[model samples]
Target: MLDTEAFRDRMATLPHDLSEYARVQTGPASWSAHPHAEELSAWALEDHVDPALVRTTALLVDISPTDVPHVAVPHADVAQLVSHREAFVVASINGEATLETMLDIVGLPSGELLAIICSLCARGIVALDRSHRLVTR
Candidate 1:
């Protein structure tokens, strides 16, 4: 398993508000930027997945069987279907959104919504909130 506590400690030091799409941490050694870094961070935190694991998983998404364990989000299909904007929007209101609100905002059929959310849940991108509402991580 990933060192979640250590990852959380590292994440706490980052700027809460970032202007870029991606930021990479090289374990106190170096940092790089990605086009989807911030979005990834938001998704990971909300879902309770370690942010470092998210980054590592994203990097290995295209490669089969690398040293690191695989993560389910950032998959090719999921990436094609969702954008950073969608992820950000989902993560922001996941705590408060009702099914009706989500239907209105996403403008998708009920079946589609269920399928998309199910896929997200499988990938650890979305989860149930304390109130049992669907929330994105």
Candidate 2:
């Protein structure tokens, strides 16, 4: 008894790139994606992501509803995110806030939060306004 149109309408309310979030239930490993290695290495460890940059950075939606790159075959991390709704919410908030604000609002561990953002960017659902640093989800 799912209402697909209502769901699409809700998605439309978000600032995302007109893409639909896939409904899935599984561990992140099950999603089958390889969030870019370069991105992970660049931002994951020992990197406080420069307070100035984090303060100024914002995430943007890139993929369209019909073009959510991994909807048909999700990336491994997407499964992990299935339960981490806060990360998705934080991503949406990124439209106006900086990463520091995202961290303050979401309260996820920085590494985990950065990973989630990076994974989403890798997937194509989100992007840093400054660079293609993260991809999608």
Candidate 3:
């Protein structure tokens, strides 16, 4: 028993541009410095649409859970994009480690970690290799 009219009204009330609502006030300088700021902001928006799932599917379409997650970018470059727990996940990767291993090491909820990974991937800061392993672009 759903109220179709009410649902339509509620949906109409939502912002036409969710990204406008999601935009962070990083100031003018940050926006200019970071070429991917808008993309990141779009990724940060957590509506019913899952950006992580979309990005993961598009980029690693053939990847499996067993695929090893590796950090190919230099630590200094990674510092610019990730912080806190996300940084820990990037740092914990050494040589070869699976997604499960990263989860165990970072101890973050899967959704949160996946969001971070999606953000990095979207920024061209991380990528997947032909071997189907996560890597830095």
lDDT of 3 by residue, 33-81 (tens): 6889887778666476666556765754554555565666787788887
Clashes of 3: 0
Model 1, TM vs. native: 0.30
Query: Where does candidate 1 clash, by residue pair?
Result: 21-37, 22-37, 43-137, 46-137, 47-137
Q: Which ranges of candidate 3 are over 4 A from the true structure?
A: 1-57, 60-63, 129-137
lDDT: worst 10-residue window of model 2:
63-72
Candidates in order have lDDT scores of 0.49, 0.49, 0.65
lDDT (tens digit, per residue) of candidate 1 on 12-115: 46556653434443233222265677876777468787664564455334222111121244445544656665453354343456544665676667556544
User: Please, what is the TM-score per model?
Assistant: 0.30, 0.33, 0.46
In what order do the candidates fall by TM-score, top score first? Answer: 3, 2, 1
Clashes of each: 5, 17, 0
TM-score of 3: 0.46
lDDT of 2 by residue, 67-129 (tens): 221122234554564445534653344255556666666767866666556555554445455
Query: Which residues of candidate 2, in runs, are more than 4 Å off?
Result: 1-87, 90-94, 131-137
Give me the candidate number with maximum lDDT. 3
